[model samples]
Target chain A: MTLAQWSFDLLLAGGLLWLGWQALFEKRRFSAVVHFMAFNLLMALVWVRLSAPDIALAEAAIGAGVTGALLLTALGRLPSGTSSGAHPHRWHPHWRYLAVISACISTAWLIAVVPQLPSPGLAGEIEAVMPATGVDHAVTAVLLNIRALDTLLEVAVMLAAVVLVWSLGPTLRPLPPATILPGLPALSRLLHPLFLLVPTYLLWRGTHAPGGAFPAGAVLGAGGVLMLLADEVGWMQRQHWQRLLRLLLVSGLALFVLVGLGGLLMTGTFLSIPLGVARLLIMAVEIAMALSIALMLMALYLYGEPGQ
Target chain B: MSDYYATVAALLCGMAVIGLFRAHDLLHRILALNVLASAVFLLLVTLARTESGTDPVPHVMVLTGIVVAVSTTAAALALTIRAYERRRQREDER
Candidate 1:
């Protein structure tokens, strides 16, 4: 909290608010998407300000990068007229705007009053229990150990969502052919190995640094998306990988659940694997999750079959 | 003051909601929703940084939120793509 940092944060928050308002009130869908992207980037900066570098990276990669790509892909699939046309009706309805304003103000007021609220007295309780669980990170302890069941369920939900999407038929559009990037083939050839290096580095760095599964997964996903976008792989070729991709998608959840259950056999508790084993198991689960997430995201972006 | 950053974050959140409400196209709405999610993440992180040292709770919360966000986004995109295909099919028939 230097004055400078404080002011910077204020500027970002104000910018976010302004962008959000503009995006909502704006009539044009294309403009709204641009504004939304801007808003996401600013939000990532806000995460950085909050001392959560891990989240900041995720926001930047997944929230801003991958999400934006998905939106743009969807936009491409839609009929141009539907998005480009003006609304048939005038933008009146002042009452609705008023309502939104009132709701937002009330919510802000409530948040402002949170400081005055009494402490829950759970912080100490949780801290006391942390060592007993053999986990150092309080949040990790809560998410993976104490509330391991919840985490497992959450992973299941993610898996179910992917399955649900798969049940829906042919959503992928034929991507346009890639043109040679001027003098870039040589560069790409040189950089291909570098790209491989980056994701592995990110994964290894996650052990101690702010990077983690989510961000690393996103980066890997982006690489895949880029390859497709560049038409490096033919649609028919990509189709051949579908079965393998499906396995990768579920591998993370499978690893997590199996290891967690193994703990039950030994320790007589779900997700309560021994300390040294737990770290190794969690890391394994994370790697799997990262791969699963990346594939799932890429598939979602690509929609159904690539050729169709 | 820190309030300024909070205000900016709050404002972005508002804009995101506005984008969602105003968007006529499904893709636009999805983008707006992502914006809103980002703003919320920012708000949480900011609030969590009040003390001298960083709070692990918010970091973990944000991490989990990111995974959840991406998962939901994937599902939503899949649904949207399906809807688009069906619409196109109906159009061709007509």
Candidate 2:
């Protein structure tokens, strides 16, 4: 690598390390969180540097946006104070030498191996079958068509997580609305349409671009959390809406399974979308996955299941 | 170039592991855990870069990972906050 390039990478790596240190060890809770968000933002840059814009978008949205919101919300609810009360385990005197020796050995091994590692992946194989997948973007094709079984299980995991959270019941003892911030209604109003508009755009973009269900769903989930945080989604707690919400949450997996079974009936294999209808079917699956993912993430952000 | 990122990612993993153990509480530990996750992602993506072209599979895998990581973090935070709130309420009563 050129000196300039090496310098830049070193600087970026150093920045990440510094930010990580501050985030983990900073005496103040609020500042640590802020530092952590900054680290995620920097990580988005690193993703781009590695030529993975899809991951950069996902990292920026879910890692920085949704996760930052969750940490902040949790911070507000939990007992807030400076960080002097807790204590770390008092390591045995001999532990330090062991830790240092292991650290040195691992570092040496990583340095030796990382530089000589050959680039190996399925790029060629995926490229060969890209057209059959019917998505213009190879990444989308892989996620929605090629390895869709993984996607299927991922949605199930999300469903399980939301169920786990809901089982906790509502732990958030509702505080007064004034505790959140000023001009809250306007912020929520402003963000509502943008959230809707952006995710739809992202959904469309995913067919040929770095956008996909994860990023779109992440933005949608952010909007949901915003609405809930603003306490504007009180209507969701109503009986009629609860059914709709539950349906929205499950529609992804249910529809995905049905489509997979349809593939079985038509092609003698599950999840194998027929070529003639691959594009349309992939779109349908993408939309379903996006919706389910969005709601699942939104559900996870809730203090607990609403209307419990 | 890939080597540079790989080395950085390795160092990051080291730091995050140290921080994860050293962290005083669940919140701090969770943040370190996120950093550790990011380090692993960096390493995987860095390895995807070849003389030919970047791989889509690793990118897809990392995207899925990000979603899973966030969900698990949310679940963990939800549980931790619950316990903290309950403990605080008891302290207030006492």
Candidate 3:
């Protein structure tokens, strides 16, 4: 690498370490969250340095964006008077020192073994079969075709998460409400149309490029969150609407399983799509997965039945 | 060069463990767990980079992991909030 490139990488590494330290040692929980979000954005840049744009997009969009929103929501729900950041014992916890020592030892052990790790592992193998999977992107092929069972189960896990969150009971509303969109019509107008196009574009681009279902679903879910934040009477408030939302939450997993079963009947193995029409099958599954994943994420943000 | 990145990733992991151990609040613990997950993802992506090109398999694995991490975080936060509300309600009744 050139001097410039090496310096950039060093900068990213330094930034990540410093930000992580700030996030952990900060006195206030809010500042820690801010540092953590900054750390995530930097990590996405590190992924790009490592030549993995797909991971970079997911890291930035979901890891930083959606997760930050979730953390802030939880932070808002905590008792305001509790001083949640203040620990009774200001002194460093002794066990934490021990934990750090153990972690360092393990990290040393990992470093010793990392040099021996094989390279080009499963990439050539996956790439060779990419044509059969009907996706130009090798990552998509692995996710939606070759190792699709894992993806199917992941969808199920997300569905279960929504169900679990729903059981927690009702939306935690901020008093006075945060529907500030009326004050900023320009911001609302810009976001409203952009949300629609971005998700669709990301989904469409997934077949060939770094963008895919996860980021698309995340973007869609973020839009849902923005809508929820805008008004007191949110989208999922009605009793009848709750039933439909629940169905939408599970629809992705249901469609994935049904498709897998169909694939099994067509071929000998589970989730094995025939070589013919692989593109059609994969796209259909992705669309269903994106829609369901979007609803599941949004439902998690809403957290239980929408309060009246 | 990749090894350098990997070392940083490992150190981040160490930081995460320490943060989790020291953090008293549920939200703090969750944040540390997220830092830990990001460390693991960084390690995998860095390792997947080869002399030829990057591996796609690990990329997908990390992508799946990111989604799973968000889902679990949401569930944990919901539970934390619910417990807090329940305790406050009980105190009010008393």
Candidate 4:
């Protein structure tokens, strides 16, 4: 790498480290939140530096945007009277700390040894067949085709998490309006239209670009969370839409499973849909999954209770 | 050239980890975690760039990691907020 590249890397790393340290050492909860936001933005820069534009987009939106918003909201809900000073008792117990230290040491040792491990001979074989899958991106091929079962299971896990949160209780408990921020209503109204369009664009672009269903869904879910915070969805309206959302939530998984099973009938293998049909099927599944994930995330965020 | 840059990046990762360990508040811990994650991504990208032929595998992995991280963060934040709300309610009851 050129000197410029080396310096840039150093600067990025230094910035990240500084933010991390500040976040952990900071005494004030509010300052910690700010540091966390800065850390996330730096992480996004790291993604860009890594040449992963898709990841950068998702990290910026979901990591910095939605996660920060949620943290701040949570902090706002905290009792104002709680002592904000140092609480030594809050730290993990000595045995717990020792256990964590051992775990970290082992993990570091494993990672250090990874580079010395022998490479599998099948890497070339996997690469050779990648182009035939109609996806140029090997990672995409792995996720959407070669090992789609794992991806399917991941989606199921997300759904299960939503369900777990939902079952907790009535998440729509009316807090005293005192916690609502000023001008949130106007802000939500202005951003609502853009929210609807951006996710669709992201989803569509995933076919040829770095964007995909997961990021798009998270962005849409963030928008939904914003609407909820602004109280834009009244109790009755939320209840009315809940039923529709329930269907969309499962539609993606249903499509994926059905298409995979259908392929078995014709091709004698699970998820073996033809290349031409696979693209269409994958896109359809992504869209359905996006919708489902978005709704599920929004519900999870708003309800603050998992398993329903 | 890439080796030099990678060395710097690796050092930064060490610093970020130290910060994460030192942080006392939840928000700070999250921030430190993000920093740690950034370092990992940087290392991966640097490794990818060192290849004689540009391979998109690292790029794809980074993208997937980003999405997963965000989803995990969103859920974690929701839980945090819920916990805070509960604590507040309990305090009021007392």
| Candidate 1 lDDT by residue in tens digits, A55-91 | 7777777777777776666666666664532343545
Q: Which ten-residue region of model 3 chain A has the weakest summed lDDT?
A: A175-184
How good is the docking of model 1, by CAPRI class?
Answer: acceptable
A46-74 in candidate 3: lDDT tens per residue? 88888888778777777787788888877
Error of 3 at A195 (Å): 1.4
In model 2, what is the error at residue A8, expressed in angstroms?
Answer: 4.6
Residue by residue across A1-308, what tens digits does model 2's lDDT show? 69997787778888988998899778678899999999999999888878888888878878888899889888887667653224567798689668866776786787678877776777888889998888889889999899999888888887888898888886365722437676777899998999999989998999898887888888888788777777787766766688889998999899889989999999999999998988888788778888888788777877587765
Query: Candidate 3 lDDT (Cα, whole model)?
Result: 0.80
Residue A250 lDDT (model 4) = 82
TM-score: the better of candidates 1 and 3: 3
DockQ per model, Cα: 0.46, 0.64, 0.63, 0.33
Among incorrect, acceptable, medium and high, the docking class of model 4 is acceptable
Model 4 TM-score relative to the real fold = 0.78
- State the number of backbone clashes in model 4: 18
Write the residue-wise lDDT of candidate 3 on B3-75 in tens digits: 8888888888888887887777777788899999989888888778886666788888898998899999999
For each candidate, give its TM-score against the true structure.
Answer: 0.82, 0.92, 0.92, 0.78
Model 1: what TM-score?
Answer: 0.82
Give the clash count for each candidate. 18, 0, 0, 18
Chain B only: TM-score of model 4: 0.87
